[model samples]
Target chain A: MEMDSGERFIVPPVNVRETADQIIVEAEMPGIDKNRLEIMLKEKDLFILGRRAKEEPSMGDPVWQEIPHYDFRRVFALGDHVNRSSIHASFDNGVLTLRIAKAEEAKPKKIEVAFA
Target chain B: MQLIRRNRNTTPDLGGLERLQRELSDFFDWTTSAYPTPFRTFGLLEGAWSPALDLYEDKDSLRVVVELPGLKKDEFEATVHGDTLVIQGERKSESEQKKENFYRVERIYGQFHRAVTLPTPVDASKVKASYKDGVLEVILPKKEETKPKQIPVTIQSE
Candidate 1:
């Protein structure tokens, strides 16, 4: 059984980067394991979800506690340049990293300068 | 706990009444325990949050776990000073940025430190730390004297 303090739905910090070949999205979701993390892509949106068990009281009373247990649900709008099928993900040190390679058509091309 | 800021002037939400209520308990506020440095905690500013920490002890060890996402293994360091455990780290933003490219920035940067006075004595030398999945785990084994002792008593049958 879980008690709902009405304190849920956290927006974890996210960083989006555009490299020459791929778009890298990294989200900070500490204390969550791979099993609890859910990543989904729907059309132009990428959704990341994670659930963390509530913070329980330990053996002794706490002198001060400012943090409440939180679950994470964050979404990012993905551009058409990304190839959704080739997306790769890895979780490490509480950070979730997702790499979506850019489609060949999206890669920039330098037109050769024709000498007149 | 004391909170220290250079100059604490921030612009409030412009979304009026509805936004005001949401902003009031906004979890992104800097004091939201995601940023655990500068000696104070629980500050509430829009879109600002700090890392949260948990400290608990078992019969043989005291554990300190910090939720530090988006940080590298070398970014954090933990040490024992006197009877206290000190953790210091820095999160450097990977992007220098084109300014306009950012949709939203909630992750915190700069150096942060937390010095916790351990509940009891611990074997300082044996303290171990590991960083994985953005969480830093510090296991401090309790000192010999601090471990619970079991004493036997003579049976008294009258």
Candidate 2:
């Protein structure tokens, strides 16, 4: 989803790992509501978009600011051999986890060696 | 090496100095190690990590917000001592994959301890804290005596 004009965005930190048959991507996006998050797969790219609900006016004026009050956006290039159709995602505790399975061609194959 | 891309120029950006510092750090991090230890694990070795904090003040209260993604409600502790608010917690790694299995690891883990002094005196008994969506918020109500009071000026006619 596209943010409104003049909206700011922060790049959420991510951790990517590969297993024998699948790849895992975890993005940390604190303060974002589940309904405001979107994950899209286009061609060979995986996109994650999220926006935190605007702070309440009663939250008061900022005395010390460290965390950015901006939307979250990050993209990762999916490997060519990943199974885009079989990708799965889950959100919990403000973390978005995506699991993309590797296609058969990408999995390791053991060849039989025979005496000839 | 450029598998990950961040959004730039499409939206309002951070201050130039902050952006430059972040870019420089990212560059050094990408170039320093053969494996590019993103999270470093050095904070874990040092026994403590400090989470980012934001403090806000209004007429009635001081609000403290902490960024602590992936932590369960039970994983952290928050307390107020005198005029200081202290938050201490540990965020364990979610995946137990081997070191080499990671293509990139930028998420921080291990223990974290953060403390911030409240600007004005607060009523300790009315303080409240809650955790939601990986963010921790603590609200401390200002002391009744310290709250601004308007005294009516009386005119004495001679």
Candidate 3:
């Protein structure tokens, strides 16, 4: 759902993890459409912004509301060792996943032990 | 090599009451590790998390829309139990295939249960539910008497 940006409220919750080959960043963002999401990569910093689709006001009395609506914004400082060109992103369920591949030289290398 | 890892794992370096809280999580309490705030886990424990819900009655039916992002249709169970509409599901944690270090953690993962007491009696058999883009919408047709009636008045002119 495409929507003109509304008020930015809270930073969506996220879990970031690094591995030998890639760094995975997962953000919990429900009610956000892929068309309204923005991902930016600059230098060594990565920016993620998501906007919750505006709910069309319907005719009816609201019975219950526990979830407050809000947009999502977060920034992460990636290191110079990350491969900028290989970054990948996909959204599923209500979570956004961003995979930042590491530079070739940054991957963990196992040294073979030799006994003479 | 300096390995700088700032992660809030299942077991962190916390002592005293915080440690007690963690233990409570093991028992009946489930504090979504990544939630910035803490849910008291001492008495009756709330499920790991409860998705936000909106229930309303329209002209023809009662509608319910629940927020449960990242969950596949099969991952959640939604049904009307007695007078309550129950939605329950689990948010799986990302796999630890070849993890090195984590920089930040905030998302909460685990099981969740949300039950809303339906206000009006509805036709249980006609309930329809659909899950898309992490949202669940359930529509229940209202009973005959419960529906709003429109009475038209005939013009009485001499």
Candidate 4:
């Protein structure tokens, strides 16, 4: 389905990887300002909103143009094992890196054998 | 009249208008401008880099702010040709000592050019450009004719 401009939501491309202790989500959001970006987590869902500004040209006169002004937002559903309270996000340059550490119960535990 | 009436969500007939608006918005957001064959193909292959633009219009001029991360002031060039503003720049990836274990890479690199057309004529002579913290701001003073004029009011007893 085509996405409407006023839809206020987008599915940003994301890469999710699970390590021993945390699940990392690297989202590509080039051109977005760190200050203008908003990150939120509620329950098992994460939301991101940001705007990507366009460059203007310094010409004596503008007779024609093409670019348009717009913003983007995305929401993702996190797995049950994710620790919502421990989730951390940071924006560097334009990429948004999210780290969600898994709950203690979610990690595999090594059980020792009892010698009788 | 029919199309307008059909679009009224308040009324059952407004469904068409709602649909049209949704369609138009989708079209605007996803569609790319019609460029020459080479440019059009390049845009398709390299992904459309529309980069969100914010234009704030004031009494004297219009200010445009563009987010351009990883862009250096010297690496990019901006110029106004007629009513169009063109920004061309190259984003080079940082040097890597070894090409080992390189998997998926999606970041855009190489020369990129974006052009924006002003809705109203601007006084190009008063244009100013500044770059800070990876954001590029351009100020374009509107032409005298395009600036909103405040009509003088003569007090008269009615």
* Candidate that scores best on DockQ: 2
Our model 3 lands, by Cα RMSD against the true structure, at 9.6
Q: Residues A1-116, candidate 3, lDDT per residue (tens digit)?
A: 12224543555667788877998888877777888888987666677878777775572777767556776776677787889899899999778999989999999899999999
DockQ of each: 0.32, 0.57, 0.48, 0.10
Q: What ordering of candidates by lDDT runs from best to worst? A: 2, 3, 1, 4
Interface RMSD, candidates in the order listed: 6.2, 3.6, 3.6, 8.7
lDDT of 3 by residue, B37-116 (tens): 22333222332455678877877888888888778767788888767777777767554444357765556556767677
- The estimated TM-scores of all candidates read 0.67, 0.77, 0.74, 0.47
lDDT for each residue of candidate 1 in A12-99, tens digit (9 for 90 to 100): 6666667778777777788787778888877676778777754534534443344445677666667777788998999887778888
Model 4 off-target regions past 4 Å?
A1-7, A10-38, A50-72, A79-85, A92-95, A101-116, B1-48, B52-59, B67-75, B81-84, B92-110, B117-126, B130-135, B142-158
Q: Tell me which of candidates 1 and 3 scores higher on TM-score.
A: 3
True contacts kept of each: 0.40, 0.76, 0.72, 0.06
Cα lDDT of model 4 by residue, B1-158, tens digit: 11001110121122555646744654564455221001121122223444445556666776666656556667887787767767767666432433323222333445566566766789888899987645677888889998888899999999
Off by over 4 Å in 1: A1-7, A52-68, A103-106, B1-50, B96-104, B148-158
Candidate 4 chain B, which ten residues in sequence have the lowest lDDT sum?
B1-10
Number of clashes found in candidate 4 = 22
Which regions in candidate 2 have their CA more than 4 angstroms from the true location?
A: A1-8, A54-57, A109-116, B1-48, B95-100
Ranking by TM-score: 2, 3, 1, 4
Clashing pairs in 2: none
Model 1 DockQ vs. reference:
0.32
Q: Any residue pairs clashing in model 3, and if so which?
A: A18-B100, A93-B70, A94-B69, A94-B70
